[model samples]
Target: MSKTILITGASRGFGKLWADAFLQRGDKVIATARNLKDLQDLSDKYGQALLPLQLDVNDRAAVFAAVQKAQQHTGRIDVLINNAGYGLFGAVEETTEQEARAQMETNFFGLLWASQAVLPIMRAQGGGHIIQVSSILGLVTLPVLGLYNASKFAVEGLSETLATEVKQFGIHVTMIEPNGFTTDWAGASAASTTPMEEYAGLRKAFSDSATPDSFGNPAATTPAILKLVDSAQPPLRLLLGKVALPFAKSVYEARLAEWDQWQEVAHAAHG
Candidate 1:
């Protein structure tokens, strides 16, 4: 069945690639971005199969309006892809209150508002899928990326809760945990704090670990993403990229080891 997939931040990066892939598969896409002009080319290529709308996920009101418009245009929203987010790089102490709040506003609250906007409609339609673009950072911490990590972690929690809450309504929520991807997400979309001498070593280490082209091509995950959307028994969490799976395993292993080491202390809390 051809689905009507509404994608935020559809102007570029993984979101843009998803839009193209969905269109290729003959699915309807309601592509959205802050600047509608960025989506004009997609509109031309896919014709009516693609609907471009202006949406700033940060604006709660705008999110509702965009969802309404999408439902109106397509008559159904089969999938709602919340992909409008950015990385804010900096150590915990290096970030300012305003910067941290802004990061949360877009990466966490923005996704929350969009999810809220779509739920009622999905209930009315009888079923839908909510795909959230999270990160491996959501499961494991990284130096110089505390703010971004916090945002993704919040997304992971919300998406998990949403899955359980909406399962009865036939709505599915999937959190996509992609490691470094060759997308503008690491380029133009990312914002870095003013470098401080205290965090210089951490910053240098981060850069050294991430070599040029170290990230996997975003398009390589397109097929997997589509399969996830099309699956009736979709997983609550889907990790993309070669490193994402192994890295997540390591994180869980380390976490379990800590639990085992402090099992007595953990039980004491409940006692």
Candidate 2:
């Protein structure tokens, strides 16, 4: 059966691609972005199949109103993809408190609000799926991306817990951990904190390691997402991209090994 999906951040990047893919698959997509103009072409191309709505996920009222509109369109929202977020790169000490909070508001609380807005409707309709477009940073940290990593880590935790909480209602939660994709993810629009004079050396090191071009193609991960959407038993967590998959695997393995090596002490400490 074709599903009705509401995707946030549908203006560009993975969100735009996902919206298009869903439309191509005959699924109804309520594509949302901060600016409706950003989705004008898609709206023209897909017509009624793509309902472009302006939504700042951080706005609770806007999110609820958008959900109401989407529910009216299809009477049910089968999937809610929270793909609206951006990275803020800087050293921990160099990044301002406001900047860090702004990242969390969009990447973490934004998702929380959207999910909260949809839960009631999903409960009334019986079931739904929540797809969180997290990142490899959710599981592992890297230099210059502490703020982003924190936000994703928060999503990982919330999505995991929400999965169990909503299981009885038939709602499924999936966290997408994509490695660097050839999206405009690292573009100028994706802000970096004002470098602090005191942290110049660290900032330089971070810039040297983090570049916009260091990742896989966005198209490469789309098929995997489509497959999961079509599957009868989709995984709760999906690690996408060649770079992301290996990186996630290594992180999980290393953590496991560390745990095994310290299991006795861990048990003793917990007890």
Candidate 3:
């Protein structure tokens, strides 16, 4: 059976790769990018299997309208992939108010609107999958990229809550927590704050931590994602890169240890 999958940010990166894969496999794909021109190649290649829409995820009304149009086109949307987000690279102090709000508007609220828009359609259909493209940074912290981390963390929280709330409606939500990948996330798609001289050392350390091996190939993630979406019972959260699990484990362990060390205070606070 061919599924209807709607993906945001389909112009490039994982969204484009996944959209092509689905279309190749005979699924109906409604791909959205900020510019329809960017999706011209896919539209040309896939023909009717591809529905490319120009969308700025930051536009709330447009998101709802787009999703409604997609539902009308396919009759039903089997899956919705929220991949329209970018990274804001900077230390927290260096980030401006406008930059912070812009990050939340697109990365957080954009996703929220898309999810909200699809819920009614999926509910009427009795079942559907919603995949949120989050980051490992959502679960852990890193130097610089503070606003980006905050946005993803918000994504994680919202998706987790949504998963539990919608399970009864036969709606499944999965958060794809990927580590660094060979996407333009840190390049073309990224916004950066002005560099501060005081945090120069911290910035250098952050740069040094990212070796060539730290990033995964975007194309290589196809198999895992396919398996996930095809499963009878998919996980609420899926890590997309080799390093994501181990890094998350280490981070969680440290968090647990710190909590345990302050166990007395934690218990006392409840009093």
Best by lDDT: 3
Top TM-score prediction, candidate number:
3
The better candidate by TM-score, 1 or 3, is: 3
All candidates' lDDT scores?
A: 0.91, 0.88, 0.94
What is the alpha-carbon lDDT of model 3 when measured against the actual structure? 0.94
After aligning candidate 2 to the native by TM-score, how far in Å is the CA of 22 from where it should be?
1.3
- Across 99-184, the per-residue lDDT of candidate 2 in tens digits comes to 98899999999999999999999899898888999998999988778999999999999999999999999888899998888788
In order of appearance, the predictions have TM-scores of: 0.97, 0.92, 0.98
lDDT of 3 by residue, 208-258 (tens): 888999999999999998888887799999988899999999999999999
Candidate 1 on 1-271: residue-level lDDT in tens? 8999999988999999999999999999999999998988888898999999998888899899989989998899999999999999888888998999999999999999999999999999899999999999998988989999999999999989999999999999999999898888878999988888988887888889986555898889999988998999899989888888888888899999999999999899996
Task: List clash counts for every candidate, in order.
Answer: 0, 0, 0
lDDT of 1 at 135: 94
> What local lDDT score does residue 26 receive in model 2, on the 0 to 100 scale?
89
lDDT of 1 at 74: 89
